[model samples]
Target: MQTLQAQIQIPPEFVLISKVEYEELLNNTLDGKFLSLKEVAEHIGCSTAYLKNEILYHPRYKEEIEKWCHFPTSSGDHYRFHAKSLYQFLDRESVKLFLKKKY
Candidate 1:
């Protein structure tokens, strides 16, 4: 399995925050309002196919995402994810802490 480093394009804005502030933002987010798979792909600026196959479906990140956050659509096949949860998962512990400090 490949590391997240190989798949996602983390932005410079994210790189600039202190670890403490980041963690607070991640932990403080509310639990509702999710993003559909398509929305997530768009937010991450990646193709849906790429996100599904390489990031979501891939064995490594798949379990992590499923365990941390995921919701099945009404169809019960595709998954939807709470945007806040997804962000929390993607941002490192340090990043989350940094976000907290800013808020």
Candidate 2:
């Protein structure tokens, strides 16, 4: 086996996430809401691919997903998020309205 060295240069924006930012990412009323990416995708009935593509790419996505899951790296950075944030991302109310309009 060969050893490999690689440096993943994270964007400055992705680096400066503060504690306040993490706390604000959750809905205060949604108690004990932590989830993994697989959990979120399963709950939303979406593929992880869709989460990365549609949801994660939406203008409001970063703020939202960051509130819903974690990507804890070996760099001592805990990027965990809450679960309710996923519901907010789905915007079930808006989808309901849109479907109502369609029908």
Candidate 3:
């Protein structure tokens, strides 16, 4: 058997998100609605592939998404998330920008 792993090159802008900013992004972006990946992509005006590649499937955000994205089950690359968690994961870059300006 052989294993292949593609190296994920994180952009220079990635940052560790604080709990408060994460919560705030959720509050601003979500409205207690549970949605599928496709729906979420629509809600945020992006392609589902973009969401998966940049946020969910990115190794840089794996730990954070595991903690906050609320994946209901572990099954391949297919996953679902509560709206808030999904937004938090998707909007983390924006949250980092917000934090940069706040302090």
The true-versus-predicted C-alpha distance at residue 53 of model 3, in Å, is 1.0
Residues 1-103 of candidate 2: C-alpha lDDT, one tens digit per residue: 9999998888877765778877776446566766666776666676776656655555655664555567566886644556565566567544732242310
Which candidate gets the maximum lDDT versus the true structure?
A: 1
TM-scores, all models, native as reference = 0.51, 0.43, 0.46
Error of 2 at 74 (Å): 5.9
Q: Which stretches of model 2 miss by more than 4 angstroms?
A: 1-30, 64-79, 92-103
Query: Please, what are the lDDT tens digits per residue for candidate 1 over residues 1-103?
Result: 8656556778877666688998887766655676778887777666777667666776756677887556454776767786776886666543432343321
| Candidate 2 TM-score, true structure as reference | 0.43
Candidate numbers, best lDDT first, in rank order: 1, 3, 2
Residue range 3-103, candidate 3, lDDT tens digits: 99898777889966789998888677656666777787777666776767666676867687676455536656555667776666556666542332311
Error of 1 at 64 (Å): 1.4
